[model samples]
Target: MTFDKNSFSLAGKVALITGGARGIGQFYSIALSKYGADIFVVSASQKGWEDTTQKVEANGQKVAFLQQDITNPDAADDIVAAAVAEFGHLDILINNAGVQLRNDVLDFKDEDWRSVIDVNLNGLYYLSHAAAKVMAKQQHGKIINIGSMQSYRAGKRIFPYTASKHAVMGLTKAYADALAPYHIQVNGLAPGYISTEMTKPLQEDPVRGPEIAAHIPSGDWGQPEQLMGPMVFLASEASDYVTGVMLPVDGGYLLR
Candidate 1:
């Protein structure tokens, strides 16, 4: 086969990104759109999506916003259906919606634990399953799950978040194994500590912040835009032969 550089192009494709209203999810939405894919975003609220929509539109791609909590039992099907309805087809699914609560294990409430698992693991599975059905029919697709540094190592005061991310890696591999025959690529992007609203606490901490950065070989936290290249590669034809793997976009955090 000819090695056309345009193999990275997402022209004529549609992508569904969960938790896409802000933070890392927002970057993923805009980056994918910049490469030629129309975007469908699902978030708990639509309040702050205007900028995301504008960014995608500025890329000359259409964007659709959906206000739905992934934790809702029926939301998976509804989300997939809505994306298909908007663009008439779905080509990529990014399971970027996740939640985390930090508390000492002894003081962690059961409700908080369940909430983390619901959004991070259970909800992701439902959405991936629903999207896989659609992709299977087309016999080609990509499912990119957003994992975390916690996906590989344990972190203090975030037990549930740690557990849920670990499960995400497992699901990525399982889905890849089962869906490969249908030409669907199931993989994950495990981001290291990135500067975002969600990690503001860590960034603000005088001691913890420096300690975290010191451990990273890069000696700095990652920026959201740094993830664009990896995201596009996994979501486009460039990764046709890749599946069942977790690609770390960390600033060499894992190396240490």
Candidate 2:
């Protein structure tokens, strides 16, 4: 059988992306939609997705949005149920919702610590477990977790965020090991200092900005759109054999 890798297309697949309204999630949603997947977006807020919905629709794809906070444990089941109800099945899941709170380690509040971990790590567990149940029964699925460069390095002021990302990679590997038997591929994408709304403040700082740029081997910040190709590869048949790997989309920052 001569294989033409053009089978990499995500056509007819259904993808559910958490935090799909903005930042990297928005980019992932649109990228997948353009690759022929129907997108079901799960977001904490509906206020910002009008443009996202339109963009998906313009790509000749169907899209639905759920405005529910993922921090709610039950939100995971609700979001997956809604997506499966609308699309019949979930072929892909992107756990891309996260937040960061920078504080001096000595001054970090208990609430702040708990909140960051709850959303970044716990929410992913809630959602991934929900999706995995469905995927396992169906015997096929793809999970692409959005990790961070912080997963590898410890910065001065963001302890909780760093801890949460490291936990995310751990969760990715464990899930991949457990789900691989069901043919579900679970993987992580660790982005380094991307130029997004979340990183705008850091990028704009005269001191922090130059310091970060210098640390990256490419000497610049990465763009959210730059992840589209790798996202598609992982979500499609091209990555059928790939699992539990943290693919860094950094500008060679890890090499520094």
Candidate 3:
């Protein structure tokens, strides 16, 4: 067999990205489109998708938008069906939708804990399961679950978020092992402290911001765009042999 230089090209493919309207999800959507994949963006709301749609279209790729709360039990089926209906098939699935709540463990409410788990862990599994069926039928696909720094280490005041992220890594491995026979690759992208809307408060904190940066060997927070290369590689044929791994795009934060 010969290595194709264009293995990273997503031409003629279709990708479904959850929480794709803003933040890191937006970058993932744009990056995949730039590599020649049509995009299907699923978010909690459609209010901010216009820009994402425009950007994907600007890349000469078609895009479809869907608004649904991933926490809803039926959302997985609906999201998968909608993407397939819009594009005729689904080639890549990015489980990027997530939620985080910060509170001391003693003060954390039960509802808040459940909510975080619902969106971050349970919802991702449901969606991945639904997409896996479709990909199995086609005998090829990529599933990239969005993990976080918390996936590997515990963080103060974010117990639920940390737990959910840790579960994501496990899900990636379990799904990868089970789905390997079907030619579907299951993996994860664990991002470090990126400057996204969700993390704006921490980034703008006069003291916390610099303190966090100092810990990172890179000496700065990661920009959303920095994730583009890793996203494209995992979503495309360039990573056909890779599965069940969590690739950290953390600007060397993990090294410390």
Candidate 4:
């Protein structure tokens, strides 16, 4: 019944972001920390997280790191355990870790197909399943899955990535429904053409860059920082009534 801006703050919240060492995931880590959340970063690569950790700590937020291949079946439980041990509880889980390998469906290798699905879809389920248990018991939490524009549109090639994203939406909805009783809100953020390490090559393509930009109403590539607001909203009480929905922070690309 009362309004408080601090209700939007993540103070005392603990968040775990997979693939938090780089790209969009790295931005998620720092942005949440800036809003007063302590951060736990889980990733297969640790090379880039040292800088991310420094930024979070610089913001006066406690941060922790775990190096593990989230595709591994056991990695999810381990991540949740480490986070709970470090912070005593978790209030947010960002399933931002994903892999995209471009290949025509006809030529897509078996391993590429499996690997993309493993990291993007299977790993998400594993991690979400683990975190939901802890959160369900507590009856309060947020699970934000990093979906993609591919979830709604299929571009050329990248069949596996498209398939995985589409599947992610279903998982988001199912979890949202099942966890609603426990007060654990689940949602997805679908980013379109964000300028990040994984997307740099595509954006750099002499032909592709301008072509893609022309379609986006914003007429530019979006930065990771642009996504911070939506991330914080869904993680905070602002979106307590929003769930099982894929909010596209796409500069209107999907409309075109």
- The lDDT values for all models are 0.94, 0.91, 0.93, 0.91
Instruction: Compose the digit string of candidate 1's lDDT tens values, residues 137-194.
Output: 9999999999989999987899999999999999999999999999999999999889
What's the true lDDT of residue 35 in model 3?
90
How many residue pairs of model 2 clash at the backbone? Answer: 0
Q: Write the per-residue lDDT of candidate 2 for residues 2-107, one digit (tens) a residue.
A: 3466657889999999888787888998999998999999887785689898999999999998888889858888889999999999999999989899888789
lDDT per residue for candidate 3 within 1-256, as digits (tens), equals 3468689899999999999878889999999999999999999887668899789999999999988998886999999999999999999999999988888878989999999999999999999999999999999999999999999999889999999999999999999999999999999999988887778989889999998899899798998899999999999898999999999989888888
Reference-based TM-score of each model: 0.98, 0.97, 0.97, 0.97
- C-alpha lDDT (0 to 100) for residue 223 of candidate 1: 93
Cα lDDT tens digits, model 4, 8-44, are 8899999999988788888899889999999999988
Could you list the CA RMSD of all candidates, in the order they appear? 0.9, 1.3, 1.1, 1.1
- Write down the lDDT that model 2 would get: 0.91
Q: What clash count goes with each model?
A: 0, 0, 0, 0
User: How well does model 3 score by local distance difference test?
Assistant: 0.93
Q: Write down the worst ten-residue block by lDDT for model 2.
A: 1-10
Better of 1 and 2 by TM-score: 1
Worst 10 residues of 1 by lDDT: 1-10
Name the candidate that leads on lDDT. Answer: 1
Worst 10 residues of 3 by lDDT: 1-10
